[model samples]
Target: MTNETKIPNTRWWRILPATVLVYIVANIDRANISFAMAGGMMEDLGLDAVAIGMAIGIFFWGYLLLQVPGGHLAERKSAKHFIAAMIVIWGGCATICGFISTSFEFNVVRFILGIAEGGIFPAILVIISHWFPPAERARANSIFLLSFPLSAIISGPISGWLIATWGWREMFIIEGVASIALIFLWMPLIADRPSKAKWLSAEERNWIESELAAEAAAKKAAAATNKSATKTSYRELVFDINLWKMVAVYFLICCAFYVLSFWLPTIIKDILKADIGMVGWLSALPNIAAALGIVFFGRMADKSQNRRKYCIIPYVCVGLCIIASVFTASYSGWLSFAFLCLCGFFWLSGHPVLWTIVAETFQPEVAGGARGAINALGNLSGFFAPMLLGYMIQNYSRDAGMYIFAVLVFLAAVIVWSMPKNAETKAAVEKTREHVAATTNAHA
Candidate 1:
């Protein structure tokens, strides 16, 4: 766009493999508790549905509160440093959780894990914005995001194997040790930008800088024309109609997501009466489906440049699939599995849209804070989703819990659709195109 011609290289893809791999590890550690519960975790800990819900939901308690501050910090510091540090802290806490024999100790360790885990998403969002331009951001995000599904898919079987073979304690210990190893590996590999990385070619550096320079020029132009552009406070993002709408949409999605994370394995092992191995495998299926969905939809989002449609469509599909899942779970095994896969697929597709939209809405300077604010507020749903599902499951039936989930998903879909479509994004895109044309003409 800046008329800086540079050959595209494949070096960006290399960082992606390691980045996405650690991302997968992070999610796996976050999600492994669901699988652990299927083992003797619930029985030994003497946890009821409510207590279990609290345990899972508590991670978000600290996570929600720290998001904005973490975002601000991420903007100031290197994301690699933030991510590496948090990994160690959370991994250490997770390992200690394995040693906790009492419910109080378990809660304490989980709370610590929550605090350590809080900054990851916001930091990653900030990194994505810095690393890739709007044109490539969705695809880049999708690649890193591939870890979500991979984590989900792998967590069940891996945790199950560890739990069944070695014991659940060992699963935490092994995951923690692996996380520490990943931190060191990630250090030498990840850089804040291509310019900072010695391995990146000059062409690659120019390409990244050119993409960003165009964006900066556009923002400078906008700031000259609009008072809000020049004087807008980060806090104002909270009140902006579009930002709030996005937050509400994400809140609903988080509600559905955390519910599944907390309760899915338990439902399989307890309600469906599945064996431990079966529970692990079944739990992994939805995650695998979700992983596939992220890749497919993420690429599509980039190709089409239609973030809103991608965001809305998948959510509607997720709600429908959840409803179908509720009914199918009462039917044959194959039907149940099919519905879970469908539900997981659509549920997973919404994430790239969520983060990408935040990146698009704000300027790069405040993007981290914006992401943090959205995530912090939206994650409040994390507090309620699991606890509500737990209550429903305890008081009613698993069927009722699924019905409740379906309703929440539908509500989330509505919120996503209600977000005001900024014609500004399209305008910015057109301007970017025109600027590129002018620059090319001048260079020629």
Candidate 2:
């Protein structure tokens, strides 16, 4: 604003694609298990629904081990190096999944894979925080999160075809090797922050640095007025009521999300009475809707001050759609599929807003650890959701587990609604708005 040229958004072009690609590969490795289950891994390994669920759920246990430490390392050390090492290690574990003969062996490899992949999410979030300022963060998060649905869209048919043509073993080998190869691409493209990026012009770097510094100052100012504004340590953060509220919300959200992610292939196959290949193609539809919803709702949240409303609305809609899909499945497969697409749209779209809330709530110093703790605790539901759903599907009707998913998502919305307003985030947003306005005036 002080006679400097307007900073270009060079970070988005340089940073987003690399992050998106890394997540896509990571998700493909994570989610391809669903395809493996549907495409005969269960029968080959002599696993029932319960046994497979346990194997799938066990991954989350290992996932919890590294999250906090990974986040701390990324914040204190280097995200680029941390993520690169994880990619190589996880890729090796994923490849080992194809070679396992016993259920114990499968579970072991999956646990190792989970440990390898645990830190990647929080590390990437830290990286995003370093480069994008508060005002642009929601949209940046949404774009990065596109990898979730986009991975499903790509992996669905591709995984199905791979299994059909070769075998589930080969599918695992192929995807794992592909994830390993991506390390080369990720290493060269990513920088820890704008300051470290050689490709960034001095003006852009200065703009980013100044904007981030102003937000940090705003947070410190807010902390002076609000007793609970800043948390200094993990022990203090654990006892914080606001942190627990967010963890509860995220835990419920993950319950619904993982249920759909892990079970959708089998659900689709059941609905249409179709083969695995057709199920793969059909599974892509819901994710296409999810992709569109993320872009639209992410922009909408960025434009509005009441981002909480955006989060609440989508969660409520997701709950309703899940119930509707269950009811419609008996009458019409296509109708049921339509409702599932709606569920995907709403559930996935709300994620960026939720993360934006977390990013805004914490200071830069504790942001990494706070995010890691929330993510680790929230993801514990990933373990229980699948196992519970599998037990329900095995014992009762398929729709039985879905009813619980609907209720869980509804509860998530209620938690979001009840959470107290975040004073620190509000102050930061106000400061960001003032900074933007001043910059505009300076340009004029």
Candidate 3:
């Protein structure tokens, strides 16, 4: 079918299922390390918390380096093929992680894993941007993000059990196999954009086109008029104030999130003096809270149509919770459990809206690249959060670690608040729509 003939009525119903499955595997692979660490990988490897954190953080090093290129590739390639290829490679690496005995080997596998997985989130974001209109974007993002929490929920208990019964390596192999299975399932379902979807209804296509066109037009006009111009260059994103602000936001969020991912299982185990089975179940609690948090924040952003405040509020709340938890909770089982749930809820609440803003901020042609660049840059904190927190906990105290996280979370909120709103973003979006239309008309 011709591009024009195929543009309308994409069956989102079909695409969403496959997208969710891919997300689940991707997230589980990304996060299963937490389970490994808690399950005894650290002692077995004879590594300190700092060493483990550094190893885990190194994944971000590779992940960040490849983001822009990955984005560029996503723009040009078939999203399904790209995702499928990456999954098999990374998932295989993850499975192999189970067999490796040395820290160096672990680092190597993780670095490779990072490179392989770097493209998934940014590419998915770009795909979602094309598939859904601005009004529907948050909801779409929410649904897609559900995979993150769901993966955590599955990974936590299952991984813990695997670690207890079979060993951490076994957990990796099982999850890896699941990822490989998903690639085949995903192959037939994912297309690059709604325009390419074959099963969409004629009316649905027209409706989406109209919504996208209108939104894009407003974005363009705003961009054309904005005078406080921050000229975006491939190189200058590193130096750009707006980019830095975004980086700060990312860093802060990672502080909270990485802590939960890396340390929550340990915290639950330590606080309750729980055995492996109990620790596994307890690890799932925070993820459950996070899942609810993502859904709530996503729907709120969708309802409010305001990304900035929506993103900021939850982050700030997370910071407050971190501070409060450090003081009130005696590390008793019940208090720790309650605090974990609260921290998880608030800490994760910002992501859906933040991701939505990231999707809306860039031009479609380069959206993937920009998203990847920002995400890559922003992700630098992922490495540090684990390292820094682990160090603090080992040397200072858990309270000290929580305090540091509170500070970082608060810092992220400040940066988000400081960022000059691109009132022009909406206009730029609108202009792009008009440009696409004019080009289409000219061709006709």
Candidate 4:
């Protein structure tokens, strides 16, 4: 009867908070530019609407290239040092981004920031997959993801105030400094694997190790039962239709999310004709809605037995609300913003369920890389989404982009509704086999 056995839930508190903190900073760095753009960065740099979108979208381009490689590095090397080093690097990038005068400098910094920050999520997911058993994994993931919206909620007002008073440079440098300081906390606290968790008693260690092993065996058994969907390799992952389907679903979601995030302040300002401070506070409203949605949908995905049903609902809501907001914008500004808030809610909620499904789809052997790939490919939406919206807003109306987002997310919902489940992991293997056959037949 060790303390570890007595305190199974305690590690969760330690892990979740630290992980949450890292992502909060990551997202703030990722998203604070939106506030800056609205503040005075645009005017100072002489950026037009299209250029603004390009600056925002460019981060994902470098981030996209590193997905599989970064995951591999984290999996192969030391996650603690690896992740810490990247944070410090990106923190530096974030700080430097504040001083840049031209569009080129801004885009260069953004692309570098993407490269630095891109690996953290997948590596964290890989870490989470190791620490918790299957039963607890989804919830842990949800909590991790919840950090994004939570960070967004806080960043809006804080960034707005910082920009309004101290200026955009101050906001970036301050946030970047905060991220750099977090490295000390991370290096000391995080253990690469359960065996390395010095805080856990030997008995507790055994329990965790055994539990994870049993889960793996169970997954393997399920794979056996499903007739060998468990076989995976880098080759299979690239060619697998199912994985590609997941990527497509996430790309659509990313489009809506990045568009909403990068443009929300502008939209709010346009509606209310507000100052930077007011825009900051007003921008937080949708984030507040999104934060609640993340929590609600996290629990919803965990408790519900059917994955597709749970996943599809939020996306449908995203699509419908986005479209409705477009119509609502005609009559009432407040009403339109409210609908957009609802869209944020559903848009943010979709990730927990989507990743949960992705977890079930890929074997643990490849889950880390798989997540990186999904994130990489999916996040390409971040690049394209801003550009798309920039074009629409530049050419048409501010609300014009929402129509495309609505259609895309609706189609994503349909894809999720249509996808086959893991069938306990064997279905995943079967998918590969089927995909290979279909490809061969097509070429033949």
Candidates 1 and 3, the one with greater lDDT: 1
RMSD values, in order shown? 2.5, 2.3, 4.2, 7.6
TM-score for model 1? 0.93
Candidate 2: pairs in clash: none
Best by lDDT: 2
Mind sharing the TM-score for model 4? 0.91
The count of backbone overlaps in candidate 2 is 0
| Local accuracy of candidate 3 as per-residue lDDT tens digits, 1-444 | 223334443445766667777888888888888888877888899889889898889888878766887777777776667777888888788788888899999999998888888888787777777778876688778778778778888877788778888888888888887777777787777778667767667666665666666665555455555322333445544445555567668877886787777777777777778887788887787778878888888888877777888788888888887776667657456775787678777777787787777656554555677778778877777788888887887889888888888888888888778765645665565466666667767877
Off by over 4 Å in 3: 1-12, 224-240, 421-444
Whole-model lDDT values for every prediction: 0.76, 0.88, 0.75, 0.80
Better of 2 and 3 by TM-score: 2
Model 3 residue 338 lDDT?
Answer: 81
Model 2 misplaced regions, further than 4 Å: 2-6, 224-226, 422-424, 427-429, 432-444
Clashes of 4: 1
Score candidate 2 by lDDT: 0.88
Could you tell me how far off, in angstroms, the CA of residue 161 lies in candidate 3 after the best superposition? 1.9
Tell me the lDDT of candidate 1: 0.76
Give the alpha carbon lDDT tens digit for every residue of 1-444 in model 4.
Answer: 212336466558767788888999999999998999888899999999899889998999978876877777767666677789889999999999888989999999999999999888888877777787554566778788878888988998899989888999999999988889999888777887878888876655665665566555555657655422474678767777778888899999888888888888888887767888988888877877877887887777666535677679998999899888888776888998888887877777878777777766666767778889989999999889998888988799767778888899999999898788644553333444345446556876
lDDT of 2 at 327: 99
Q: Per-prediction TM-score, please?
A: 0.93, 0.95, 0.89, 0.91
